[model samples]
Target chain A: MMHRIDAEALAYSYTSGQRVLDDVSTHVATGEVTGIIGPNGAGKSTLLQLLCGLLSPESGNVLLNKSPLEQYTDRERARLVAYMPQSVSPAFSLTVREVVALGRFPHLGPFGSLGTPDHEIVQDCLGQTETSHLATRDFLSLSGGERQRVLLASVLAQEPQLLLLDEPTSSLDLPHEAAFFRQLRTLSGRGLGIVVVTHDINMAAQFCDRLVLLGKDHRLVNQGGPSEVLQADILTDAYGSPLLVGEHPQTGGPFVTAPVGGI
Target chain B: MTLGNTRFLLLLGLVSCAVIFTCSIFIGTETLDLGQAWRELRSLTPLSEAPTLSILLMQRIPRTLAAFLAGGGLAVAGCAFQALLRNPLATPYTLGVASAGALGAWVAFLLADVTAAIPLLALLTSKQVMAFLFAGLDVFLVYLLAARRIHTSPAVLLLAGVTLGMLANAGIMFSRYLARPDRLVNMDRWLMGGVDVLGYQPVLLLAVGVIPCAAVLLLQAARYDQFAFGTTLAAGRGVNIGRLQTTTFFVGSLITAVIVSEVGPIGFVGLIIPHGVRLLTGPSHRLLMPLSIVAGGAFLCACDIVARRILPGETPIGIITTMVGGPVFLYLLVRRRFSDWNV
Candidate 1:
């Protein structure tokens, strides 16, 4: 199958002169979990935004299945890709089910009245995210992990072909993070193209099909399999102080950890 | 409450409000029994013998109906504005729409005869045209102040609205200053707001306008649900954010403007009723919109009743609403501090 996303020389900047993403280009294959890793302010989120068509590029364009992203209407683009932000705090206290059902907006008409299909999709998404019990709970009242799950459920309800998650597990504990990634793995296995932006190199190495390393100048320094991308020099260069990379004994995936540099 | 229980309670509240409305007609200064009131209502008895029935049917009934319609319209408008702006503090008054409408009404009141003589070009040629122009101008000002380089923030929108309201109030004071001393009473009474001054014609007009608009708003409830997630998410989910915002604001402002034109500027019925309904029925606009309308009707009817019988003559309904709504709102704020409600 052709790649879901093909970007060529994509660049973006917040202001007129300051470039946040500089001449970055990459491709995301079908059914692959592509992880984007970079230090803080490395423009990972900006790149994700560019890919999702949330921000138009200053230089190049992103192609969704060969067609330019800009050519698609907002609804059509939404049906093709689901982009989840790093953290979303709702201004009002919507119930978990109400929030999840919002994903059906694209499918509904101008009024967005839900039919049986919308309700079914909402139910499926809630069950898939293990938030069926929390459906009636207030979204604002949920813990960070639970909120993440509910938000994920909302995105899943969109049922998009490409899933873009910006730091999905940023607020989760180790166990929850592992479980979350496990769910992502299951999703990718179902032939959904997933692109997750994260700073957790070890988690990326374990779950991702490929890793795209980003640098401060909004450039892609390397892109390859986890074994090639998670090298000690690459880690140190990317993070400024990363120490070690080793293979996990059970999974045989690369495990990266930062050592205390000089006391 | 369970969803079923909430629906049940809402229905019960509606029935109770209707019953209270009927009872309100019977218990005035000159008390009439329900039978006499019914006979007068049926036109079987002369109104002169039953003064209370006459008052209830002719004066208080129309006033109460007007109060109900205006209150419901304002409250539902507030709910739409609050959701559209994503600010809890957003209301028709806070957004300057009420003040704009007041300015429009004031202009109409001041230049009752001159409106027909003014040419289109000359109409735009003076500061007196400011009041007539302020209604549309205030909306533009709100849009300009709220919008930043990227998009509008709800907090900024709220602040902009407050600023516009203050400016309109200043204009009101200036208009009052220019008027003769004899005219001050009319200005003061209109500024204070009352449903009693309205008759069946305006009430009928309000009913004609509000019922259809309310239905349209109710139909768009699901869009509001999508919007509650955030603008980006809503947009990403295929909601035309700009279109939705424009439609909601236009409809909401129209409802508010009509009500303000008919009555004076009633306060807080919009702000309090919607929030109160949201507290009972969760924040689903599907439920919130309809419930706000019903609750608003009940609340305003109750308030109008209190305004009428609380003293010798009827006090302004606006005073009663604020007097009751302010304390209730404060109580909710205080209770939220100790409770699990996160809104």
Candidate 2:
């Protein structure tokens, strides 16, 4: 019943005077996988940043646990929300375990070293993300899919109540993308709120409990369960083209197919 | 890159440092008379009775201490610079702080000669103080320009440092032209980098300045590891990036400044030690930073011994480091595949 993160009428503009998000209000609830789905440049990433308090909105407020997000210290916010950006590649030859251990920084003191329990959590997270075998390997040598999973394990080690990911599957192959979403679905069942920005409408429909569609103008156009919001006309208008909405043959969930020619 | 075998390597390094440091004190121009030195060391004889003790106290001890300080300070500063810039080639010298410090010392030399009575000239004549002042100025200028333009991008900071260094070098040339011909050789000698001082003051000063900076750097080992993941990920992991950048830049420059002011820019130690240690210890700063400091200090101390004994006359320490560092750097480069630069 409690909201993990609530953004009220958030707006943001770059220094070049170009607005990214305009009057966008959204909230992420516990134990649900919420997907922000839209075409390119819909400000989904910006909205996620605002929710994580990485960027302050030009107007409106983001609250965490009923307190203004800005009031929490950087370490406190990091402990509450785990965010994984779109790209993470090691510039040095750090081992995979070292990379995942970074997620425990917010919980560590200035001179504190990792103790037994911390190692246990790191191992558990690595196993949950299917990366336990790669713990001793060099992070720089991992394949793209493996790298993303390792990064996900790192974020999971933060042990936050809210998890935010930005285009995590943008570079992944089809099978890996499906596997990643399945992992997220499994994670959401454990009662953590998950918000992911994705362009794959079908995956959003199949795995996400709710979807918020953003238009090109950087406004939230519609929000609801997959069957209620994935209407043909709404998606066509949102994407600026003709789209077909259908049901998955077996699961009966919503599916999307862009038409070859506009009607 | 793993610490599993590094404990053995670290133990070997520490023993070598101790052996070199002790052997250096005994093998000066005149071999320390062991019987007399032992008596003096045990306090069985007074200073006037034991000439070997005077030689050891007045010359060998301070010189060894200076060499150790210069080597350790530069290497730790090198590690910090490389991590902050995310570039292994980013040594403290790359930032132009050394050149500016040298220019400051050059100006002080000229002023001390032109006027013998002024109290201000008396202070500047120390040369070390003057070098620190100028290094501070260079660091300030680089940070100011970077913050105003690119908000402290590592690439921008590197460019700014190189430009400022070139300007300071030009100032050095102009000062040299105005300097009396007799003082020109003195300028050249200072730049050559020697640790032949005869008193305890400089050694004490260097130790007091370098140890705290090294401690601060060691404390940030975890943060440096996060920085290897890129700034965005570092911040996501709760690192205060702005504060980390400022603290590292300030402390690294200060360490380099104090060492350069004391012994001039001992070239290549900064660049070589970190790379060498990284090869053995991997990239975790927790093990990399402190090990580099110890290895660098021992390395330079050993080089000084070679400089003192290899030829009839002593060669400058900088020349020795370059001669050694150049080949090692080449080996590292030749061994590395282009894929190592993938990140």
Candidate 3:
């Protein structure tokens, strides 16, 4: 399989002269769900932005399919990668279907007149994300979890080869969070590469094909299978607190817990 | 069912516009009966003794047409400004474009009167040039003041526009102070925004200026809709945000300039029509824009008719619209509190 994402010595700094990503380099394998977990301000979102080509890195380069990301045109980049931001406010009170149809913009001209195939693809995306029932509903009227699902449907409507999601389940309840991760797994199984940034380490341990831990200094500290990398010491060190790490009896995957201090 | 409801509303608006337009043509300073109006309209040859035909063709036709154009143009311009600034309260007057246009017309009027007396600058007898200069200068000031930062915040832009508008209003008041007592009445009538005094020349000029600008605004409806979906989403959808913003502002300001030049700052049409249409059409510019044009046209025509017949002589249509729009706007605010759709 082809390598979906290749980063080498990536570095980024905000205007505040604070570094968010420091010489970070990692590869995302095709058809795998790579989970990025870190404390707040660890540059997880910034790194995802750089990888998705939404923001150019201050140094180093990101390559997709062994080609420099800058080499692809805007439309080509959109067809190849879809980025779902962490927080967004819907400015217009559009229906869920209308918002999802915007994913076809790269394939459309300035007017965005959708063709027959575009309609079919949008319907398919809504179906995949289980948002078909909410297609005609007003987007602003939906609950937070429902809005997240609609946004995911919009991203899927692009039919992108690689998907980047930042805190996709941040607002979702436990059951919806599990269902969303399952949908991500199904997408990965279909040969689509996925990179998801999450605060939920336990969820990452359960579903992620590989877990990449980021330290507070915005550097990659560990990268391996969940069972190998999610040890109690590493979890405590990354979180800067006392924590417990155990195995799920049923799935045989790592499960992390924060324990009382001096444990 | 929703699509059917939308079509029905659009059809109703169109029919109302037609009826109002016809009534505006028939009822004026000198009323023309339907038979006389029809005969005058059907006649190809000019009747030497037909005073009614002459009056209809010369006075009412131009005034009615001006009302239609000004109403529709201002409403569309207002809708564009509201969408571009992302504020519900934005209008040509509030944004300073109308004030600027009024300044331009005032300068033209003063220059025309002065040039008529001075034989030296007789070559500059054309008042149209002065009007154009005033509008151009006003829009330039608005753009410069509101565009300091690369990231155009709608609130800041609107604040700048309003500040400039107040400055222009001050300039107009200064001009009024300088004017002789006799010209004050004429200036008052112009400021009140009556349709009675306009001729076909200014009406044709307004049509020339506004139609192309409105067409450009209509074509950008989808881009505006994406913009309404927020700046980042618009960019993600492949829109060049800077370019879209510049184009929308330019076109919107151009239409506002033209309407202000002809009608002298009719209020409330721009502020109310777009929001009202959004409530009916669900905030999509695809439907809101066309509906705004139709509803604006009808609303203004109806206002003008009421202005003519409400008393013996014609009152300014602005008075009628403001009086009506204020209560309706309040009612809408109350209704919005109960409704789920807050656009």
Give me the candidate number with maximum DockQ.
2
Runs of candidate 1 exceeding 4 Å displacement: A1-3, A15-17, A92-95, A109-120, A133-137, A231-263, B1-3, B20-62, B107-115, B119-163, B197-201, B204-216, B333-343
Would you list the C-alpha lDDT of every candidate in the order shown?
0.79, 0.84, 0.78
**TM-score of predicted chain A against the true chain A, for each candidate:** 0.96, 0.97, 0.96
Candidate 3 C-alpha lDDT tens digits along B1-343: 2679988988988888888888988886667876775676687547455667777777777887888888888888888877766666667766777777777677666676767777656444343445445555666666675556535655576677778878878988988898889988988788778666445887897789778988888887777777655665556555666777777767776777667666777877887888777777877777888889888877888888888876657888777777876676566545643132234
Q: Which of the two candidates, 2 or 3, achieves a greater lDDT against the reference?
A: 2
Worst 10 residues of 3 chain B by lDDT: B334-343
Model 1: what TM-score? 0.84
How close to the true structure is residue B248 of candidate 1, measured as C-alpha lDDT? 78
lDDT for each residue of candidate 2 in A89-165, tens digit (9 for 90 to 100): 56676678988998888888776378889999999999999999999998888999999999999999999889999
C-alpha TM-scores of all predictions? 0.84, 0.91, 0.82
Q: Model 1: clashing residue pairs?
A: none
Q: Residue B184 of candidate 3: its Cα lDDT? A: 88
- The superposed Cα distance between candidate 2 and the true structure at residue A193, in angstroms, equals 1.6
Give me the runs in candidate 3 sitting further than 4 Å from their true place. Answer: A1-19, A22-30, A56-76, A114-116, A210-213, A219-246, B1-3, B33-50, B94-97, B100-168, B179-182, B332-343
What CA RMSD would candidate 2 show? 3.2
Q: Ranking under lDDT, best-scoring first?
A: 2, 1, 3
> For chain B alone, what TM-score does every candidate structure achieve against the true structure?
0.85, 0.86, 0.84
